[model samples]
Target: MRHQDERPEAPWAATNRPPMGWNSWDSYGTTVTEAEVLANARFLAGHDEGVLAAAGWDTVVVDIQWYEPTARPGGYNDDAPVLFDDHGFLQPVPARFPSSAGGRGFAPLASAVHDLGLRFGLHLMRGIARRAVEADLPVPGTPYRTGEIADTSSTCPWNSDCYGLRHDHPGAQAWLDAMVDHVVGWGVDFLKVDDMLAPYHRDAVEALSLAVRRAEQRHGRRVVVSLSPGTELSLAHLEHLREHADLWRVSDDLWDRWPDVEAQLGRMARWAPHSGPAGWADADMLPLGRIGVRAERGEPRHSLLTTDERRALLSLWCLARSPLFVGGDLPTSDAATVADLAHPGLLEVAHRSGGGRELLREGPTGAETAVWGAATPDGATRWVGVFSTAAEARRVRVPAAAAGLPGAPDVVVDVWSGERVPLASAGPATGGDTVLDVEVPAHGVRLLRLGTRAHSGTPGPEEHTWQG
Candidate 1:
């Protein structure tokens, strides 16, 4: 890992806040068509009547296998025949993306998305395409073949579409440079590179980061670079991670299961300190809304998680300040799910606060109350997320001082329900600290925002009481 002082300045990392967007993986798998992408982009950008656009959901990503013409739903076609150009660069299969028929690539689709007031992103399997190396295609603008620069020994375990690059080879970085330049030329505002971190490929990560920087410099276009599938990501890589990609996944694909949501409690606690601007430790995509329409996992339906579980999931992500990428198909989702995502108060925590971290997590294994806290940059307002990871409903309480606030807040507004939960005076045990006592449903969360001063903001009209 390189020292912090030695790292080059990355203007691309100036994305100063975690990005919020929609991704096609969960709903369309590897088979998402240009039409499907446009539908989701339209929903995100309000090409029709999407409310999420104004709520900060601005980027739309077409995830994985865009070049395989024969790609289908369920799972990737093993050793599939994917298409790339004579220069060893993958091209969107015209069969799936008709606009790319004349080697136009994603330019037209990206233009359509930009016209809707949203950014366009694409997912690339890290390294050179396997078939391109097999075909021994020449690395464009280089006097070398793709096979000569590919390290065939390193390949994805679950997918055989690509092989790792031989960083020692001079043409290795050249190939990445050309490919990145090609993709970014299509007006791609964000780029996701997968199969980079499962085994922690340091050299590949550095090369790819340099490639993105090189391309952005050449095209005078900014692109957010994300690394993924961090199955067992370690905190030791913090400095290196910050110097490279915009946001890197801290865990493998998080789905809409309670256990999946439960597991992130520890990951977020460990990684939140390093999350800010372009250097976030991603908790994976929010698997809410309607997932599994034609996914790599499960059958088509609304998310398997209950309403309470979904609330906990989003609250955890926002309070921890992780990036938000909805894994579900947005256009086909129900109104309630859509509204929950676009809620003003909930998003404010992610957009307006700082100092996000886990305050404490106590109680038994299945009955834990995890508290996470954050505040506005000026520290005038604070946010707390009280989560119930129990098998049944329970009342949890935490003192304002313990929650790291200046004192008892003038008003405590629940970010989710927009209701007021008045602070209660505690006895001698807590040293006279005011506390918030409330009944939290099993697998549910109470996301709270505090005004340390007099009425900085008021809660919604509806009032709810947990106890007197």
Candidate 2:
């Protein structure tokens, strides 16, 4: 294990905030087509003044199985031949992505997305394609053959499409370099590398990171690398993670159920301390609006969570400062769903705030409530999130002192409602001992922005409300 101070400096220093985007996985899964991807990209890149574009949701990521010719919902053909170039580099399946037919690859689609003023990304599994190894193809810019670099003994536990590369093999780094160069030419802005971090493939991650850095230097492009499906990672590996990728998952796939959302409270808390400007602990994609429309996990349907649950989910993710990857079919999303994603207050907390930390978590079994807090960019205001995990409505309270906001706050704005919530004394306390009490609906949240007396003025009638 490397000490915090002994770790190498991070390769990519341009990621100032967590990424905000829409992914094709939760909604379209392995069977997502080029037409579907373009539709979502159009939805995200709506008129320059559209809600999504205005909220800085400018990335459109095409998830896994894009190279498979016969991919479908809930099924993967492990025996299907993997597609690759003569140099052992993977390419899009022309049958599925027609634009890539004349060996143009994703360049045409990437240009289309770029024309819409949106960034394009792709999902990739770690290691070399199994078929490439079997074919004994040459690795571009390297003297060794693909078979020489392949580590036949190591493979993904769940997917058989690829074989792990041997870190000791002389051609491993060259192979990665070739792969990165290919994507760089295609204008990929982000690369969500899966099956690497979850199983702690340190050598592969390091090789890939270095390859990305080298490719960026060679092509003069910045491609954000994100690790996915991080089921479990030790605190000792925090330095390594930050040194390699821009974003790494903190939990496994988080679905649309309340339980999945509730489980993230603890995961986020545990990983919060490790999150910073260089790297973030992803809580997985947001499963809201219409989802699983041909997904591998379940049948197509609208999100199962209630409106309040959706709000809580966004509140928690924003307060935790996790990367926001909207996972629904954007084109089919309702107006209300779009409004939720476009909320300025939530976006502020997610992209501009800092020093986020868990404050309180307490309640009886099956009815717990949790509190998370973060400092606004200017540090004059505090963004707080109070979540009710119960099935029944609950009154959640937090003393100003507990929230690190000393003295009486002149105004407390409910982020979602844009209404001012009145503060009252918790008990026999006086002055600065005031506590805020608000009724949070079951599976709901109260996202508040605290304005201190010194920095705030009296609120108008329309802005003031007492829910206690």
Candidate 3:
């Protein structure tokens, strides 16, 4: 039951929005079973009220362990799992994916997903087969030692049991080619390959990029390959990733914590201009709703994010224009959580506008955190988001001209609360500036959609002045 995408290359280069989907690792961890994945898929796409089709969680991914059981008991690392078989081929663990064990690959699961109008995806490491090499296994068709071909000296410092690929070696290219053939043949829509960029192996990253492109030509399917866990990729590297992958991670894994979200959003704004219709800087997965894992120390066994935190979650995800990979239990998430995460206005900002920069004012630790704004296609409208992490509620002001208006006279409507708040008075005395004052709750935000006005001003006093 090997799946093959026998179509043209147009699917990969679509002129529409990028792919959207759900990943299992963020929610289920090592305890996830085949039935749970299928059930989640059903909830997402099967029924009339299916969240997947209704809300657009179109990619159903099985992260990490597909070949063997993940770590057991006391502190497990489900993020990194071993995935290979005795015969030197990759297979899904019998207990989790029964069909994949007998050379059938993931066709059964993928077909089920396609039947539900969703795409199938899986995670993989960058190098040649490691588990098989560790067992001194032989390559499928060639007469070569897996260890001899593997660059044993090169290993991911954080992960054991695998060696980095000797990119220059013939076996390395051959191994990658074969692996791509296997996955694409099995109907993989999205492939998140680890260590291709995080450790920043230039050679492997380049080779894999080429390998995936060749596979796309061979299979004639529009497969999206994504590079994972990398940060601050160079223009050259980003171009290379774009040549191969539809999206690339601009940071390491993002948790539900606010600090991580802030750091990611701050860094991603610098890469705003690079994002386009297809290529994107992924700021990692979104940990909203009720995540099942005990992510933080001494916190709840489930999600610890509050309502404000969830809004912040959506804000950062939208502001960064990253892939919206939800890390929450789909079946049990509350309506508010769903509404906040799946807000159409927010998604339009994330996908259509490509996000904007943050204008800092005053931060919590005396450091200022302010605006996250973006210009849309209409050119007259702009999305302005003000965030305050200050000790107390602070008045956040947005200048009309700075918000992409011709003059300081502008009116903005709050997207969240649906309130139209007027801008402050404008005149030569105050430098002809229109200011919109919003009282942002401590560590909270106010998002606005600003539009230009004909001519309206409130006179300012002689001593009045506008702050830069």
- The candidate that wins on TM-score is 1
lDDT per residue as tens, model 1, 22-94: 9999888898889999988887877336668766799999999999888888888889998888888889988
Q: Report each candidate's C-alpha RMSD, comma-separated, in the order given.
A: 4.8, 5.2, 7.6
> In candidate 3, what are the lDDT values of residues 236-347, reduced to their tens digit?
6766666556788887777766677657656676665576544777777777666754332223234566566567656655665566777666666666766665565565
Error of 3 at 280 (Å): 0.7
Worst 10 residues of 2 by lDDT: 459-468
- Cα-based lDDT for every prediction: 0.84, 0.80, 0.64
lDDT of 2 by residue, 46-92 (tens): 73366676566878898987887778788677756767789877788
lDDT over C-alpha atoms for residue 319 of model 3: 60
Which residue runs does candidate 3 get wrong by more than 4 Å?
A: 1-16, 46-55, 73-83, 231-236, 294-302, 359-367, 408-411, 427-430, 452-468
Model 3 alpha-carbon miss at residue 259, Å: 1.2
Of 2 and 3, the candidate ranking higher by TM-score:
2
Predicted structure with the largest lDDT when compared to the true one: 1
